[model samples]
Target: MDLLRKSIERVTPLTNEEWKLIVEKSKRIQLKKGEFLQTQHSFVVYECFVLTGSFKTYIMGENGTETVIFFTFGNEWICDLNAFYHKKQASYNIRALEDSELVVVTKPAKDVLFSKIPKLVNFHIHMIEKANIVLQQRVLDLMNKTSKERYVDFIEKNSGRLQKVNNKNLSSYLGISQEFLSKIKREGEVYNEKAR
Candidate 1:
């Protein structure tokens, strides 16, 4: 709850009444590794704030291949905004990468909060804008960068996640084969050692 308060405060200060309303409306949830927060084609009723551990959002293809869309870690938000806002089914699955804790607020609860605190709506709009920018940058990177360059950029940007996420998932997110990812990592290590 403290983390939630801090997260909100980072964007906008909350009055005691507003904070209390949020606390009363949100619920805490814990998930084990491999557990799903939302499944493909399901309605996403809650918007979640990650408290601990990591989660990945991905889509499974008809050929049984999984494409990683994005990853969210502790102190981040995870939600199918399209589904949550529009009452549509989720197009991707959100699964725990490790045992995780989250604070969740349902649509009704969020609507109530929004009505009471207009600044909260602005905060959400900012978050959505940031998400869009990140997605656009990722798309541009995939379109313009070579695999090795993309891998290097990914490593530089997500240094914290290198050890936490597996190679297979990272490869999928990078739109590269695992073998290529391995080769890139090996080459990177060699380059680093020589530089040192």
Candidate 2:
């Protein structure tokens, strides 16, 4: 709950009363690796704040292929925004990549909080803006960047995830074949060794 408070505080200061209200309304949940936090066809009733570990959100295609959309880590929020906002069923799945803890606020609880503390609305807006920017950048990268360029960009921007995330998942997220990703990684290692 303190972590949840800190994450909200990063966006807006909350009064003691507001903090108390939030703590009362949110619930803590734990999930192990391979667990599904939210699956397709379910209603997205809560928005989750990751307290520890990581998660991946993806959609399954008609051909049964899973396309990785994004990864959310500790200190980040994960939800099917459109479904949550529109009161529709989720079109994607969110699954735990590792053993994870999350603080979740239900839609009703969040609405009540917004009504009581209007300023907290800005915090949600800021989160949405950040998510949008990242989504846009990812779309652009996938469309315009070569596989190797995409891999390099991922290494530069998400170095912290390199060791935590497996090659298959990373390659899928980067829209590259696993074989190509391995080749790129091997070549990168060779280049670094020669530079040393």
lDDT scores of the candidates, listed in order: 0.90, 0.88
Give candidate 1 regions above 4 Å deviation: none
The local distance difference test score of model 1 is: 0.90
List TM-scores for all candidates, in order. 0.96, 0.96
Best by TM-score: 1
CA RMSD per model (angstroms): 1.1, 1.2
lDDT of 1 by residue, 1-196 (tens): 7988998898899999989989999999999999999999998657999999899899999999999989899998988888998999998899999999999999999999899888998789888998899889989998999999988887787788777789889899889999999898899899999999
Candidate 2 off by > 4 Å: none
Q: Which pairs of residues clash in candidate 1, taking residues 3 or more apart in a chain or in different chains?
A: none
lDDT per residue for candidate 2 within 1-196, as digits (tens), equals 7788898999999889989888888899999999999998898557999999899898888898888989888888888888888889997899899999999888888899899889999999999998899989989998998988988887887788776688878888888788988999999999999999
Model 1 Cα displacement at 17 (Å)? 1.6
